[model samples]
Target: MQMNEEKDSPAARTVAALVARARAAQQVAEGYDQQRVDELVAAAGWAIMEPARNRALAELAVADTGIGNVDDKVRKNHRKTLGLLRDLQGARSVGVIHEDADKGITEIARPVGVVCAVTPSTNPAATPANKIINALKGSNAVIVAPSPKGWSTCAQLIAHIHAQFDRIGAPRDLVQCLPAPVDKASTHELMRQCDLVVATGSQANVRAAYTCGTPAFGVGAGNVASIVDETADAELAAERIVLSKTFDNATSCSSENSLVAVASAAEPLLAALCARGAWLLGAARKAELAQLMWPEGRLSPAVIGQSATRIAEKMAAREGAGRPEWQAIATARPSMLIVEEDDFGEDHPYSGEKLSPVIALYRVADFAQAADTVRQLYAYQGAGHSVGLHSARPERALALGLRLPVSRVILNQPHCIATGGSFDNGLPFSLSMGCGTWGGNNFSDNLNYRHYLNVTRVSQPIPEQVPSEREIFGSFFDKYGTA
Candidate 1:
């Protein structure tokens, strides 16, 4: 269909109105000084990060989306926003930002105008708040287009943001969201009307953003696979992995879906994971779970982001009239489920992204085999995302980074928290991670304030310093005589 075919449609008209207001607000923001930008960002951050407000948003997010737990959602809202504020503190995104006397150039930062940020239901509150804060930091107004399941939470979040704007005398339109009845048409229209689009949900939305004829920044699908080598501290790795896998019920895209352990480390790691409340299911149970989790090759929405016990109970209910084995496991109250597998790919459904507290385990003969397994898994999915390595040998991480198609090779840390960003890590704090060209994305870095800004370099004439042919190609001529 033509882009203008739906111009008079309700969804398109709604988005067009939101974009128009956003553009007007952004024009006002464009004149903001650095201090004003920082103040506005701080206000937006505080709107979501305040404990009581965060708790409310978290509760509403869980209730609205029926995905993640409320308590962990609260933690994610607070910590992610706090971390982003920490990264953005004192950062200049206005006026003259950089200068180089030798190069006779000055760099200035400007906003990219209204931003259309498509957020996911998995992180309804935190993700949209992050985008709004970053957009404010760059003096750009933002219009959020939340998923259908996440619209209520996003609306409440926008209300909170509007209250903060009122307190600061900022325009309420500076931070807006698509009205009720959010749909693909409105999202496509917003992408078309906005100066830039930052989509961080399904691959379908990302693809739409790219094709919407707008400057877009979209993330890729996540199916993180981590390896534990022979030299790794198996206990520590297991502890970290379990923590990450169980956190928010594996709602984070960075959560490890598949784990590969060297044969020598497998048993010890398994024991440690068990100690950390990881219930290992038998092969028969694994088969049963595969069917329950992926009915007819599609992930069951009922189990996604559910606790281990909940999933076990569902499995038991599915086995009505048979033995109640899964019920017993459910009664034991495991934090997460572990299923051993030897395969990887579309044929092996367990080897892909399971958006719940379930992990697929594989045992390889050595580190080489482990890396190869990770590579093979990436070839099936999750290319240009991230891989984790829990090894004492630094060379293993280097090897993975050099050879793997992934973007980040996280070492000795929880994959979810580390892949996005953490207090101790150097990676930028963000909820959206660009997966580069390998994953069909334009950028390959964490989404941050830099992505919201348009930098202009003012160049002045410099003294002549052109290199002679002898100086420019001396090494090449010495290696092979130049004609």
Candidate 2:
């Protein structure tokens, strides 16, 4: 005999329905073998990577969210998908995945039930697509909660994935997202009911996930910084910095927010940055920008993810019709904005991340001071994220890597592109970056399909090797004599 179900509110009812469908989908997915799962993931990835469809998706993402650029987004989506496929080619994630005959143990990969991914406005399409691919690859169903601004783009992405799923006779409900009006109440309900949550937006959202009484993975805000030592090539450093800070209007959280230049190299760096079409703001202009961008001690969203010229127009103090110069810069659209500031402390608002084509300039006495200044900036916001260092001395670079709290130290590479994953580097390709405990995250690397799977260890009886106290502490005993 069945019992009567209790009446529920709209939010609870919606979440319950979605989770129920997802559970059913996951149960079917779990029956798939490793090869079948990989084939499905590959099919979805290829469909999304189709040249015409991928380009259209990029344009749609930018038009809907008003963040990032179409060209970059296209490149990001294709390349990230390709990289993930590369990483997944031979990996086993179903049934018995590993065996260690020497240790008489075997490891099995298991699905983590249903997962909920919280996506942000920037990279909305890419992030959701990647998360869906990952969840399905691990034989887990996923439900995304896209930012309100990104709902349309995410919906389109999900539909395309569903098209692929249908071709393979897979359940459509395997990938679900809160339909529209993605609000606080609905999102909270969804997170509460999901088996696991991959939260990758604002700090508040990440915190809420932690409190939802479910296992979660979250990333943090970025205030990434870089150092220019005396041995660095000012021209190359300036070129890379300007390109990175201005890429997609700096919507990437990994974009450089500050540049600590050794005193001897500061002038050359400024000249190099200027040569790259960066609008250098004098002291007065810098102060004006500060007041406008941070009117009440909080960064103004109006200037964020905007072109350089748009930013300058906001900083313009005159109340009358804007001067021709403002419009000229607007029409020309400088690559980025450069401002000089001596302060590197939290009190200095310029030292923090600005999600725009802006980079704060700081002068230091030497390389050691530069390293210390980088540490101080991370201590303010970016800790466990990453840092960029330019130097000819390997020892100096290694020393800073040892001293800083960051998980990655990009040496002579573009901070923005290199932060997540680069072909030149060994890190996994991902849009979601974990900040570790420094930024209230559990991981210090990129988030990928591997993060969504659970592992089971099977152990068999084996000869145990228990060492005696003297055997374990032989070196210490040899040094100090037995007590």
Candidate 3:
């Protein structure tokens, strides 16, 4: 009786209907050849990349979600989709992908079936579009479960996708979203019913995806701390960091949350940042900003992803205290605010991901101290996501990659654009960045086409070429006298 009741619930029924259509669509997709799959992927990409349609989606995302501006969203929709399509140009996801005579094995690619993608409000259009493209490239169906604020944008994007699918004679149901009443219950049901879940949003959603009784891929929190060492060109480093830190009001999880500058370069780097319209808050102003941002022990929604001017306005209009001394500060019209701090962890709120046009500045004695500071920052939050290094010396960048618990070490570029694949860099173009074991994620690389499919290896009998015990442990025996 309980099982029947559970199945008949409204959330369950909604999810069942969506999943039924998706599974049917995926069954048909299973027969498509690589060329057909590629065509479908192209259709999906075009649906989002078309300039007028992209503009509409971006505007709707900003108007509905109030997380980012339309201009940046428009650029993001174009570049991210274009980059992903470029990455998928010659990639194969169907039929035999590998054959090795020496190993007597053949590897064939297979679809992962219907996918449930839970996307965040910050990236209503781009995130879902990327997931849909990847799913179609693998000949799978995708159903997006967008956040409440992102529902309208996602619905419109899916409508465009369906129209494109109609033109291409593909199944319209192959890409869909949870309709009107998008609640947690509906998303939970969708996650439970799908073959796999790819969640990119709040840690709560990622955790739920992991526990949803399905194979899942989810990203982690980002508190990216970039190092500006003595060897770095201070002007260039400041220019790139400011550009990244202020993009889309810092909605990206890959955006820099903090900066650790070596003492020798700190002055010049800070001066460059100030010249680029970054305001350095005084000690009292920093405390006020912190209170305004985290009044109830959590980041207040009013300033979470708002622009620096908006945040400044909020700071100036403190509740009962009529126009505090910061009124003149607010008039500066800064592009971003800089808060210098020496501590980290829960008690120090600035140490974690800010998700806005704000940067915490830390000064260290040298490169070694900067590295140690980064390690401590990770210990507080954002382990295994990524870090940025601005230095003339390539060895310093390499050392950070080897020493820190991070997935990508972005070198001499804007951390946000470089962490997720860039045209100039080799990282896969993606919005979802898995932070590995350190951040409780399954992957340590950027999410890409390869994560959307499964591969089967067929082994044939071959002459064994086993190594002798002496050959396997020769050095071990010589040094430690193995038993």
Candidate 1 TM-score to native: 0.98
lDDT per prediction? Answer: 0.91, 0.84, 0.93
Clashing pairs in 2: none
User: Cα RMSDs of all predictions?
Assistant: 1.3, 2.9, 1.3
TM per prediction: 0.98, 0.94, 0.98
> Which regions in candidate 3 have their CA more than 4 angstroms from the true location?
1-4, 320-325
Compared with the true structure, what per-residue lDDT tens digits does model 1 show for residues 310-375? Answer: 988888888442247788889989989999988877789888999999999999999889989988
**Sliding window of 10 residues with minimal summed lDDT for model 1:** 316-325
Candidate 3: clashing pairs of residues: none
Model 1 off-target regions past 4 Å? 1-4, 320-323
Q: By descending lDDT, how would the candidates be arranged?
A: 3, 1, 2
